[model samples]
Target: MATILKRASKGKAGYGKIQFCGEQARRDGLQYFWVDTCCIDKSNACYVYLPDVSQSSSVLADNSNESWESFRKSEWFRRGWTLQELIAPASVDFFSREEVLLGNKTSLEQDICETTGIPATALRGSALSDFSVAERMSWTECRETTYKEDKAYSLLGIFDVYMPLIYGEGKDRALRRLREEIDKASRGTSLFKREDFSVSFSLSDVSDVEHFVARKIELVKIHKALGVDGSRRVVVLHGLGGIGKTQLTVAYAKRHKDDYSGIFWLNIKDENSLKQSFVKVAKQISREHPLALRLSNVDTNENLDDVVDAVKEWLSLLNNKRWLMIYDNYDSPKLPGKTDPTVVNIREFLPELY
Candidate 1:
């Protein structure tokens, strides 16, 4: 048998509204009201049917369970729309208790109606007979229970059951965090340069390479140790293209990004390109050009040495603060039968301090 139960609380104001609906039903000339409080034996906690009585049976005298249900067939359930209009005093308090017991940490002021897509006013009343109170109780317990208790399965196991009802649009945020964790595990190199240095891709996106994770971890340790050292060290990460060298440095920069005061990534593919990249990095770090007009005086008149000196001076000023200079793709030759001047100059600029 399908049963509907309402949590009743005495001395509550909302229950009076249910009584108002019942009075309206009586004024509308309805014969009987299927009010659970009067219809069911609350003392015994059992479902009992009530029968009808004639005019000889006064309404006050017909207070027994047998008189009410017999007076109205389906109409007993329909009188004044009590099924939709009745207020259950315990509805809000039950959900509040469930939320606390479940440890959801959601605010009581939060519009659960908006989040769950249930009408706020409808929930204010105890009119939801179609919903199962047992199911709600189980859901509350499942959410509040920690993974430590259910060790055999992860929290995802519990989430799968109630996700449909509980998570409306908020499911996306949970999925996004999950994807980030999966990516961090799979990539082995926590390096992705978005607006935030936090890794963004999943493990499936990273290439399979031996010692990739180890190499990145070692780089992080080196970066940390270098940060502590009063003197700056220009650690050049060099390897064949696509050997994951750039990826390693980028990952290192991202991991220890907070430790360093500033980080500059320069792609030194050619002489002119390298100079432009350095100027951009210089501007980002220093925020103002020390020799702005001189550098912008003429297009071809700008000497590579001067630009390199400016970058060196900027690095020098950051002696009290830690900084990272990432020189990417520094494999090109400067001229015919000549080594890249940019690489040679970078080494010269990064002087070892005593």
Candidate 2:
């Protein structure tokens, strides 16, 4: 672990840049160099040395359209391992045989997309979960590997799954195992699946709500509050007990049901009820989100707090915006003391609005 950390600190600096090139990388504040034949940590700066693309005087020109065409056809992009190599690194610098700096991933985003068929958002570092599984799989369609099983093995990181590598396994069996692991990982996290775009509404209180009329002003206010910007927003609907606070929120959600990715409601009258609401959200989203999958299995009968935290984390993802959560019956807010154990802290259950 210490060795890995030390290498990671200096930056992983090589894409088949070994020997003298590796020495040069070490001098440039990078201690570890990678090659096509070995694997290294993904969280490091990558320096790709394309031996086929010889150094040229016009390579770095701003109008070098032909240079990008040459880059697109480079042997580097056609390898199976290159798919992971391109996407995993936070930073990548391309170079020629004579070590002339060509450009970085940011500057070459358009060319990379054209060659690989990956979306610009993905290449620009959007969460992979935000893309569909089929779309991701298509990125590797043109890549080739030495062994048949290597094609399936190369995609382990893309799907975020792992299993023992069976070298002798045929391509069909390897792909089957890969699919099984993917299925296991995505058991109930369909909320983020690009293929499953149906809006998730788990508010049971509003099931019977219909023919909502009046509160046009209140509904408009709610819409304005949530639509102000791409940031967290909250609007507390304070009113008398029987003056229809709950009904107003229900009506707002139903009226704009198609506007959100998901809609969840929590009964915030007490701590126990709030926790129960979180459990419901967890079950509704998934027993465990991909981020929380390593923590522990979330069962309603056990580890209720894990479920609560996991659900909150799921909502906090950057790509997971457009999700609306309602805290109903928040009448008994807990005071700043142990004397009121029955009361709830509304903030504890609220997710990052954006």
Candidate 3:
């Protein structure tokens, strides 16, 4: 007679339980038994006992009513294979049974735990002991927090401040307003699109500038002179504000983005803004906030000495990799005090480039 192996419901038994059952069946004069856990493992043993269910039961029954409610709501218990069917050898096929059971267990746990405020262990017992309940709880909590955060800044709420203009618009105009609102909420960080490498420029109406052509040539020359040896080089394109300085920089960045491994463009219109922008850029590239590196206490006007130090440190590390740092509209007042004195003369930030 073929061996009869019993498997606990997907979430109620581990590999050891299934293996023990198969081994027991074989010892009882059965020729073959379809057991996922034992079949998947080469060496099989019968002495192993089912894992202790007391710990998980305590966690679940600590809040008995809640646990029962959660268990009832659980997709695993409510759906296809019953606990009896899982343990019945004649009910399921040997091949691929484990996969289907495990998938169902996982999906059910996630769905039930998310919908009902219940501890997962109580619903399925000690079967899925290896999975971390705390980690799943943390992830679910984070998602909930993010959703609630997004709700605080609703369209109606923002419209109250920018009112008449937002409501007086047509569908296309309303969409533009909505985009601006979303951009503001995201701190204007949505400037880059993944599909194409391009920078935002306000020189759309400038005809005589020929910004794109001029910057492309400059970028090629800069890349060639810098060579592929991976040395950091600074090319300062300084001119009057409206004379396409920003446009030229944006064009250069887009054209030569592929030449370098990483490219970052920053608009430093003021000293404080410059510091904040640098910190943001540093966080994006290095995964560490500049202020968090050394200073614990950070405020708006607390002197950006820490920020300048952080940027210098990051730049030194990246000296081995080719990078371009475009400082757009950097001629604002208070620039001298914000920049490093060792880098250039205090009279103007322009001398730093030289």
Candidate 4:
């Protein structure tokens, strides 16, 4: 360890990654040298006062049922320094302990997205404005720091901001301040907008909703389902044919129009209508969205199944703004077990909840 520091301190190397970084920097015509090691004083240590009492924080949430002892046992994840190094750069390339070249941030985006539940765009270094507050919190949920204050300090760069680092302020206070900054920066912004594209709302015209009576509970349920940080959700409302189920949904949408980027109302009178509606949505996204072609699961030109799948993939994206789809007047496909085996059901094309 002493020898490694000596070589690095004197702009010399022990013939490994340090040498490679210098060479790469020279190729890029950069005279400055920077390495995570020796760049920051790694030897600076802090002692934490672990309390016997359990503290409840809403920001941290209930990440696990495990005891704090078990949580602290995973030391690598509990380190404050690692997350800062992971996200503070414009682009990051990683290497194994054996010095094997893994990939840059963009190259391993799928793995990152799957691991962190962060959108692909954010991993590729898109602006922090592209993510929601909940999304930001989820990224650091599994991480920890030696100092109570540093758990919050590590996230400043992730959110692309700076704050006065008061080491004694405590992590919860630091995190709360960080959130305040985030809220201030993100203030007055609409949750759903099409800043880059010009696409019209595709749902059919509805009768006036000013007089429509609101069903508050169902509306709240839909909001919660959409806002939940995990899987995609589906809420099914079943009742007699003339029970105002469709009206209830329409009224709910009218009440909460701003909550979604788009609201699609599918009048499922028959299989043909469903297919036509799905295809229309696919074409709309393909024409209007920048990622439409990249996200294609199927070729729209060749087959109907592909187009529907493409639409599903587009909507499935976190980058895709929140959207609400109501399958009003939906009916079951099977007719009392007298089903034709060859006929394709329209319900099959609907996007399955994750």
Highest TM-score scorer: 2
> Which candidate should be chosen as best, given lDDT against the real structure?
2
- For candidate 1, lDDT tens digit of each residue in 7-74? 65535754553444345445646545454444322121111122221312343254554433233232
Question: In terms of TM-score, how similar is model 4 to the real structure?
Answer: 0.39
Per-residue alpha-carbon lDDT of candidate 4 for residues 239-337, written as tens digits (9 for 90 to 100) = 888767777787777666766666676656676666566766666654444223432334555676666677766666554546777775666554566
Which wins on lDDT, candidate 2 or candidate 4? 2
- Better candidate number, 1 or 2, judged by TM-score: 2
Cα displacement (angstroms), candidate 2, residue 248, comes to: 46
Candidates in order have lDDT scores of 0.40, 0.72, 0.40, 0.56
Q: Count the backbone clashes (under 3 Å) in each candidate.
A: 4, 0, 0, 0
Deviation of model 1 at 44, angstroms:
75
Task: Tell me which residue pairs clash in candidate 3.
Answer: none
Q: List the residue pairs that clash in candidate 4.
A: none
Tens-digit per-residue lDDT, 5-30, candidate 2 = 45543444542355545655776787
Report the poorest 10 consecutive residues by lDDT, candidate 2: 287-296
Count clashing pairs, candidate 3: 0
Runs in model 2 deviating more than 4 A are 1-16, 37-42, 190-354
Per-candidate TM equals: 0.32, 0.49, 0.36, 0.39
